[model samples]
Target chain A: MKKTCPNPAFLGFLIATAILVAIPGLSYVKQRAPETIIPGPGVTRRGSLSDYLPALKGTSADTPVFYLEGKEPGGTVLLVGGAHPNEPAGFIAPLIVVERGVAQKGRVIVVPYANGSAISHTEPLEGSPASFSLKNKAGETRVFRVGSRLSNPLDQWPDPALYVNEKGQVLSGSEMRNLNRAFPGKADGSITEQIAYAIMEIIRREKADISIDFHEASPEYTTVNAIVAHEKSLELAAEVAMYLEFDDIPITLEQSPKNLNGLSHREWGDYSDTLPFLFEAANPFMGRLRGKTDETLIIEGKDPYYLAAAKAKRLNVPYDEKGLPLSYRVARHITAFRYVLDTYNTYYEEKAIIVTDLPEYEEMAYRNLGDFLN
Target chain B: MKKRVFLLAFTLVFAILVIANGPAVPKLAEPVMITTAGQSAGAAMMKVLFTKSNIKDFVFEKLVTADEIEGYETLVIVAGASSKGLGAAGIDFDGETQRVTALIEAAKKQGMKVVVAQIEGAARRGTSSDQLFSLFVPMSDWVIIVRDADSDGFFTNLCEEHGIPLTIVEKSIEVSAQLNAVFE
Candidate 1:
């Protein structure tokens, strides 16, 4: 039992390894804390996805479902956000709705984090900022994570060779973790599919008259600044688009192709009675021609590359020196959602879902986006 | 004073607008049959415009065929190609072209006025859309388009060459007012 002294270099190496591991480990754990959502006075009850599907109970896949039930009973309208957590406008718009929107008629159900697992981690190797902060109306700084578009591999491991979704559409293996492509999901499928199944359950059980999923796309994407609505929802979508034009917010109305399967606008309409619609706003930060990948780009949405591309007539949506800021994008989504409800009320007066207190587009875009947040 | 100059300038501009009111837009008959040449959402927007304009005697058939135009007095073909929309309608570009061509020919043979419109602006303009516009605009009796759609003066030039009456609206919503002026 000589008990020789430990090698100094080896000890030094162990300390270095510990410091390296601990630093990232702490940062990774910090991201697991979900963003805070304070439901407004219009929120009559709080629920979770587990309430619709018991299997999701106590799992990270489960997320909050805030219900704004009006005093007068009417139809249900489901609003989903954060389906792809990397799209910040999709997540932030619903947060504002839940914290500020008041349901004057029918019901409004807001799901700010439709895929909790996706918001728990950042995409690997993207060099994205982990979180961004905004100051609320109370002047308190609220920090929100900029998570990955796909579910964490830790939650659902081992991507398949190819993903044939529930609708039999073939996609790449990595899309197995994409909740948007997992609609009408199997009850015993992957965690992402389970999340989809739970959302589908909400739409089916709630007898939702209208379901809208907010999304954002790169400025160069063809679908940017458009509303993809199912055939059943086309008339309402068309009316809403016209109303948006009257408000000076020009948006394209795209009929959801029946051939495109497994999407919220497609499968949700086919599988359930809900007339589904999805909105996409142009985000320069998400464009392939973006210059810097950082928090400022995400918030400010200014990129010289996009400006050059716009000048070249290479981008889909209009781009200029003014840039499309996060507030404008969020305002577009919220305003479009409001119009959808208004149009629905006009067409289906008996099953109206009239909401109030939502921020106006000009006011929200002119002021800070966080001013509407709680 | 600056006030007098400003007032005089404003009056001069007003007089110019009143004097140079542009060419008269041709009156289109009611009982209009609205259909899509490329199956784009502009057809739906046209339907809304007709409804909002209080034009009560129009029928909107997104895929109206040649035979369906027999009873209509006017054929409004909204020309903007959307590959997605064509696919959803279970037709290719050539098939859509043939169908619309036949429908327009039938309408022309019956002495029905034809109005071709492009309302969605630059987003709906492309090679296929231009082809669709070329097919419909030259044969049309009148053309109505948003200013954004003719940024390069494509529609204006085509209308000019064809000697067709064209109404260029500043916005899609303005199309309703134009529709009212044409049909009222």
Candidate 2:
């Protein structure tokens, strides 16, 4: 080699190749792949939102829908998540249902990402991380993105100076991008509005007997850890609340106001035959008084500011050192959903939706969520 | 070979320095002084004034006196100024007769550009006709109103009757552009 050494160019190429080879090995950090959910024995088929609304095809609005049919013919119910993607409990609780639930009497449909585009991006000014990961009992980790409350600006830009909702209520212009505010949406409207319209169409076409939209709110908000139901669904919601109260879960029941326009609970009830219910879990991460915003805060739900605020008796939800962890919130949502379903069955046997494999709030709190995840 | 290598290193350093220095320009300007009227009906509109356009320098303060007008080139007196608080402050309020005359004369003498933003919807509390006509309608050189014509009846009628120059802005972000058109 000494005698047959090539030109400097040859040596440079060898050195560069060596550097490139070393870089990959040195920089290789273990990245957990997205969780592979094993649909429970009840899941009959898997489809996409695009199947119901073709306009969503090939777009981020398109997402997976898990269909669980019972052995006997009965009414169908729909569960939607990720309407506001920042609320992880909204999406993850439904995912748990899809992965493990067993529909025994009626059909249960789940859309884990109701607004898929919202899940692709995070709020810009909020300083929120793009993604967080959780490890299951088998040491398999799943990563999920924390997204904005509104549709991605990239998908719909140039917000109107003022946005008038379907009810003719004027709101801040940026509110036009909020999927929650785009209910009873128009086919010719913006992408967010179309997504809303598509959801409405799905509910109307499916004749969903009961529709539940899962969400979370800041702990400081009065509506935190409550269930807001349309006027028609209030009695069932009250029954569910009473049941949850006996379990010491402490859930509040709110009646969706008549004047509030374009909200899912309001418009979904007004426009469709489905009984609309929206669940709100307490999320300290969404509060203004949270500490460093990281996966720890999002998953653990502990914040010193909230701790102080709790001591001052300012928070709407009770807070302790244990914090309102994701596991607890997710479990609360699952429990609420189960109770609502049970109550529906009691009141309207013809449209009853029975599902199993849902872990109780106590089990989730004690054993942790990792034990249940596949 | 050594000389060439040294020259290459020097050239790289020079290039880095040039890149780091960037283009020459003035430093970013400080925020402008903003004074809001207490009885005004446009908190939302005033909030937009901060977010709109490239105008980043806006400092909000409650309107005090003609002497307090210092550090601000423009004054925005929203609807209900005359009847609600201006009259209480000993300012003249004779329908549109005396209040507009005093406000216009005062603003001109103070070298402040007056912006009259039309009130939209009902006031959070209540308003008076004297406030609408005396303070907002005739005195303001520039008028900004919402696209919804029916939100404010008094302001709409006055603008229509007198043919005053009015800008219909839908989004609050447009306020920045409007301000830039006047001040920038």
Candidate 3:
């Protein structure tokens, strides 16, 4: 008569353990699924980062690349976003370009998720949401994953004590996983470095005349809402700044520090013939002073802490009750992108890039951000 | 009749104040040589503005030596220090200061007008920037600075002590209009 009763306490513990493991495990697995991106009418070809670096194929480091070629052959403009996935606007800006932009003259190459590995994971201990949702023009909900500034530890682990990049610049070990800091990367290096190599290869193989990387920083950051340009691209950057200033969009124009190597703006310019530019916009969601980090904060960008910081004159960008929303940040990037191409066309008619049908600053900034999404 | 007389007197007083307080800025000569004392991006921005203002015969060199200013009538040394810039240019503060000093001395010897400009605002105003400003301001005939750069009246005090004309602009973007005005 073997009627054995199970221990209720042990059963309870088992149930609790399963819940703890299953909850995060499910979320982690769910994030691996790529977000749906519909190529617009302008998109002529769809490729992967693996195309440039075959080693990236079937790996998390690979990301989608959208090419919009015009009828008239001209220069190739490479626009990359989501280098740091925690910056949602960076990811969204390129998405808009892929979903809406039309290249009229030159070819437009867009990489919405530059670091696919990073895009699938959020920074630990930050308490950020796994993903955020926005309603597309069709009123269907589209989901986007918010991720860490560094590549996922699951993919690239074992941070060294120090990281000496390809440029011989010494940085903290954690920066090794940072795609932005891994520029002109090593082909046989870490996953993040390999991804960076792929990006550089894209620039080289594509013969990109102009390369722009989208980024976002906290409002308190001195370089927020600024355009950091390489030395070769200074004139183009200055012209873009002039046009932006005339439009009442105040942006700081900073030359990329030559000594601070391993950045998109610095390394891209040094390694390739492409004139590199990095654009930064204010994101309260990433600010140290922000409170209640959530999807709303990522989308609306309203943070009372940032508001107080603004009052204390601690912020570089002007912040008020009408917080720096994702729409505004994305709009700034798009506008700056448009201006760069325009200015490039003016100076280098032989390598001119003309991209049209992209959303304007006023249209995107003043309207619902989701309206532009697909 | 008394109201009209009062208004006339007020108007005359206002006119006199306006004329007295107006900027009696001396015109900057043509063929300006734009250079950076500390290799900041301000010089590049100034070049853009000069082009926008339609200023003719100007040359921009990040590290223009005294020899380079042979044809230039005015040496506009934008005074702003960037440590990264210095490191990139492979020069220390002392070397930069010495280089700038030599350039200024040569400009002075050539009878070229020396204009020290600080146009990147308060962000570019620091100890090294001040050192560059101090050394060059005394030798400068004019100082074109953003208003924020002079928030502590450092430029004002330096220009006053050296009898230099200081043009403080509210914004860096407005410097183009001011540059055009001075050229006019």
Q: Judging by DockQ against the true structure, name the best candidate.
A: 1
- Descending-lDDT candidate ranking: 1, 3, 2
Candidate 3 chain A, poorest ten consecutive residues by summed lDDT: A241-250
Which runs of model 3 end up more than 4 angstroms from their true locations?
A1-3, B1-23, B66-71, B92-98, B121-139, B145-163, B166-184
TM-score of chain A of each: 0.97, 0.90, 0.97
Error of 2 at B66 (Å): 55
* CA lDDT, candidate 1, residue A128: 79
In angstroms, give how far residue B60 of model 2 lies from its true place.
Answer: 50
Report i-RMS for every model.
1.3, 19.7, 2.6
TM-scores of all predicted structures = 0.93, 0.62, 0.88
Between which residue pairs do clashes occur in model 3?
Answer: none
How many clashing residue pairs appear in each of the predictions shown? 0, 3, 0
lDDT of 3 by residue, A9-85 (tens): 99999999999999989988998889899888999999999998898999987899999999988999999999999
Model 3 docking category: acceptable
Model 1: number of clashes?
Answer: 0
Candidate 2 Cα outliers beyond 4 Å, as residue runs: A1-38, B1-184
